[model samples]
Target: MSKNVDYMVAIPARYASTRLAGKPLADVGGAPMIVRVCQKALESSASEVVACVDHELVAQALEPLSRQDSRLTVCMTSQNPRSGTERIAEMLRIRNIDPQTIVVNVQGDEPLITRDHIDEVAALLASSGAQMSTLCNPISSIDDVFDPNCVKVVMDKDNFALYFSRTPIPYERDNFAQGQQAVTELKFKHYHHIGIYGYRAATILDYLQKEPAAIEVAESLEQLRLLHYGMKIAVATTERPPETGVDTAADLERVNRIFASQGK
Candidate 1:
């Protein structure tokens, strides 16, 4: 399991959410969502999982969880980061983390992230030796494949991503006219982006310093900035799509339902 390698998972959480303020500390089932996230990361083969949050209220919310389990480490980061990349960069610098160690940034809102998912990503990053790595799951359903909210990724033969977009890519001009079967056959390997990311400590810092790229601003995907700067992102394919994180009130309600059903 590569226990010898030092790896850490840091969830970059913010208190402000345009859809739901104090989103990080929002309760899911019997636990705050962030606590669930931290628990999953700690379950991985990583050395540690920390919450690098901006607000004191968030810290306070996480405090009870930390007391309940001492494995969770709570740290402070700047509220000024323009992007998640910047926040991770700042956390790496503050901790004086080894540049060669692998750091996984599991989105704070994804309470359903599994321990296996975290470990699988870490293994892919180490095996591929790429600057960065992320997960993608094939879309068999026609609705999800065409859904813009399900960000699609086109990868090369080596599994290095060529581009990512909210648009349905590799457009089969004839398929839409033909109906479901035609669309499904055409998109046999269509993949949806999972927000999970792994980076070499140095690569992350380098990405933060580069100016935002043309595609980055247009697509609103920060990972595009790495591609613009000519960074190689290796992909690991998972068996199924992960549960969506809390974004809107509807998303929260959906997640709550899932958690409640599971008796979590």
Candidate 2:
């Protein structure tokens, strides 16, 4: 709703995938997954959609489409960055993007990244004056609460994140025994950490300046580093369900099936 909010969407698609090699080019329904992500960003309110990739193959794949859409670009970056945020930072530098530029990070693997959340995050950052903003969804399944890969987050009454972790947060010490009811009860307080993020290009660059915190390395959650440095992260809760990002073969098949069923 904040049309005055200036923002760009960048997808950091690293070719090195520990689980699925060349994940950016992985097929979803009919086209490459990164292409789907790019298309989604293109549909958003952002002024530009840049695909910051690591390999030539990713650049080559995105180049043809970028030529057709001026809003899209393909920039190859060094593969050695610690995380995708670092990769996006490199893109910002290479593109000479202003430090105050608001850039939304739409993960290359999340073809189904929420457009509403993208706008919400950018608006939240602009309105709340937080260094960064991200979206979270209520945990509906017990499987996800205990799933280490599915990071969880707890936010204060002011809607700023208190912490992010793999373990179930705000753990009810006197909750009901395990069952479908308990899962539903946990949903009342627990939230799934959506991987999508929005921040000023300067904010992320400043973040990289800090040394890795013990908590960050311990939890393997990069956002912890920001919180560890006392950066306030605004969180927007959404009813929209979290999409399964492609990582393994099972994940690929699952996303493909979802897209195929939707007649994409």
Candidate 3:
């Protein structure tokens, strides 16, 4: 792989999740979930993979993986990073990553993250020349459209995000009036935002330095902050249907079941 514009994966292993604390170290099958995330990152075309962790325990959990794969590295960030994006920015600054490189942020909780998706996000950024890039999958079900936790994104004709929301956006007033299950009647396409992201190292640093935008505070989505400030965020679709990320105990159980079946 080429060196400049090389995709560098950074998995933010935030130890404190409101619903599931110590989530990074949580076991899926036999290994820590973050380790599996690192393993996924390793499968990508990324030149390096760094687990940006806050606690020593999370770093310790990733130690074996680091030894096994020379590409794997660990960087400790401030305990109180405002968001995963901030954690990635801190990692770049601390490690002195090249500005021309692209930083791909894969959430530690997503054990099922695939190599294709990570590479696709980086390619989108490189091809589109956008400030950042992320992946989304078409909303196939009514439940996903209405579920607040399932964030919806609206993109322009060029596949750049216009807005992201907890609410069902570009509201299908006529179809929605029928009931929650009426989403199928809508004509417009709805996309479920995948949390994975890619940005040029310098772009992310600039993102972290900006003041929080009002829309971001209102929507509670850090990506909104990027759009609010007129940053171009390119979008790519997942290669296959998206899988559930570990957020709650129930989510972890579901992910474990998939992992077990996959024989991982």
Candidate 4:
């Protein structure tokens, strides 16, 4: 972690998940998943860690933890924000955070998220001078290349994102045209976009004001909206892949098992 960099981590802990209701309050080991995620943020070098929650139950779950750590707090936000980005934007506004302050948007479900990745993204945004910053990892499996669930990103020479999609990008025309199922060699690398983000408070507010872009709507990716409005998003590759985030019952079970094995 860069010692000079200072930032806040805002986690959007929406209670109403379609796949798993009250996901933020779901248990991982002996603790609520959002609580675990918040603990991770609190452990980081961030000057402050706030969990932006929509429900009273979610805020209540965090209260005990917040009471133990002064740096950790909870913000009650409206359920109207459609995405985590919007939720964080509202958090910034309600807190009256400085517009130029760097904020990292860490997902509430990512209990096992590493502090290194969190700090890396924030440091990148600070050093690169981009409006936003994110991380990605190389796609090792051919299945991930074709899997729509695995969002792909293509970057320029300087690592600025050119596009993000649910489909394979920088398309391998020859390989696909030849009906090759296996990747014998690579012409270009395929990268899976990591969901973590770092942005200035002002940039997030500016993003909320802009109309959604057609490509963003088509791809179901909010980051494209920033690109459409001519904002630069710095992209960096992390050597260590992030841990699994809880989205479904099976994911919750898996994470629980991992926590149990660790004697957490």
TM-score of every model versus the real structure: 0.92, 0.93, 0.93, 0.96
Candidate 1 overall lDDT versus native = 0.83
Candidate 4 C-alpha error for residue 203, in Å: 0.3
Q: Which stretches of candidate 4 lie over 4 Å from their true place?
A: 179-185
What lDDT does candidate 4 reach at residue 151? 96
- For model 3, what is the alpha-carbon lDDT of residue 137? 88
Global fold similarity of model 1 (TM-score): 0.92
Deviating ranges (above 4 Å) for candidate 1: 1-5, 177-187
Per-residue lDDT for 10-106 in model 3, tens only? 8888898889989998999899999989998899888889999999999898888899999999999988786787788888889898998888889
**CA RMSD per model (angstroms):** 2.2, 2.2, 2.0, 1.4
Cα lDDT tens digits for candidate 2, 127-221: 98888899888887777777888899999999999999997677665553464355545535689988888899889989999999999999999
After TM-score superposition, the amount by which residue 208's alpha carbon in candidate 1 deviates from its true location, in angstroms, is 1.2
lDDT of 4 by residue, 20-132 (tens): 99899898888899999999888888999999999999998989999999999899999899889889988988999999999999999999998888989999999998999
Off by over 4 Å in 3: 1-5, 178-184
- For model 2 the local lDDT of residue 135 reads 87
Highest lDDT against the true fold, candidate:
4
Q: Which should have the higher TM-score, number 1 or number 2?
A: 2
Full-model lDDT for every candidate: 0.83, 0.86, 0.86, 0.91
Q: Which window of ten consecutive residues has the lowest lDDT sum in model 1?
A: 179-188
Best by the TM-score measure: 4
